[model samples]
Target: MLNGLKVGDKAPIFEGLDQNGKKISLKDYKGKKVVLYFYPKDNTPGCTAEACNLRDNNTLLAEKGYQVVGVSIDSVESHKKFETKFELPFPLIADIDKKIVEQYGVWGEKKFMGRTFDGTHRTTFLIDEKGIIAHIIDKPKTKDHYNQIIETWEK
Candidate 1:
């Protein structure tokens, strides 16, 4: 597995289908700050909280010049359902092949309930306008995820 990426590293580029089957690429958000977040699955509790928090503050995030995008190994259909259920305003990338997660170095071994398995680690990358990583939140606070991004950027 690839080592975790750090701040100042070049943000990995990726393109994948979103909930609506439209292609989303990191390069598309060039010249703008991007909040690239990775979650284990769609519709899960923590994932839902994080996504909802971002959705609830979409206007504020936009006003702060941030574009949010979520990624998970879930299928496009699943992403669509989750987005519809939560009314998420940003695109949730369907990383079915796991390529995007691997590119961003978020795919790895995880431990939960005394069991270990390979999965996507819940992580967030703040990509600056120039495509460089401004900050990385490895252990995100699910309910206050948006604040973490904002505070990091503002700092």
Candidate 2:
């Protein structure tokens, strides 16, 4: 397991600049369920797919009292371009200092093509209204991430 956080644990509170340079924090959605997703990069294939999937289902998610937020180690400018390109409706936090990822325990060593490197692990944390982690999607399916979230919440 790449995460130290567990279901029912209090989700860590964090603040960062979103794509629009607006300050966004976990506490902003205090009374609403949160879909806090962390991705490796902004424009990568899997990341794009996951973001778009969430974008497409944003209305449905909102109807269910869920708020979506994305976090990545990319800069604010990078996130702005990605968000504009994909018409993403949610805030994408630019975690350039890596504090949020570290707090969430999603920053660690990852191996790709037999090469080891430090990066953000793609993970989704479903935080309930009370700021407690309700579920953790360690290996989210990018193309169908929204459904995955809904199903997990429903179950």
The numbered model that scores best in lDDT is 2
Off-target runs (Cα >4 Å) in candidate 1 are none
Clash list (residue pairs), candidate 1: none
Tens-place lDDT digits, model 1, residues 22-91: 9999989999999999999998899999999999999999999999999999999999999999999999
Across 30-116, the per-residue lDDT of candidate 2 in tens digits comes to 989999999999999999999999999999999999999999999999999999999999999999999999999999999999999
Candidate of highest TM-score:
2
Error at 57, model 1, angstroms: 0.6
After superposing candidate 2, which stretches have Cα over 4 Å from the reference?
Answer: 1-3
Model 2: what TM-score?
A: 0.98
Model 2 deviation from native, Cα RMSD in Å = 0.8
Superposition error at 118 for model 1 (Å): 0.6
Query: Cα-based RMSD of the predictions, in order?
Result: 1.2, 0.8
TM-score of each: 0.97, 0.98
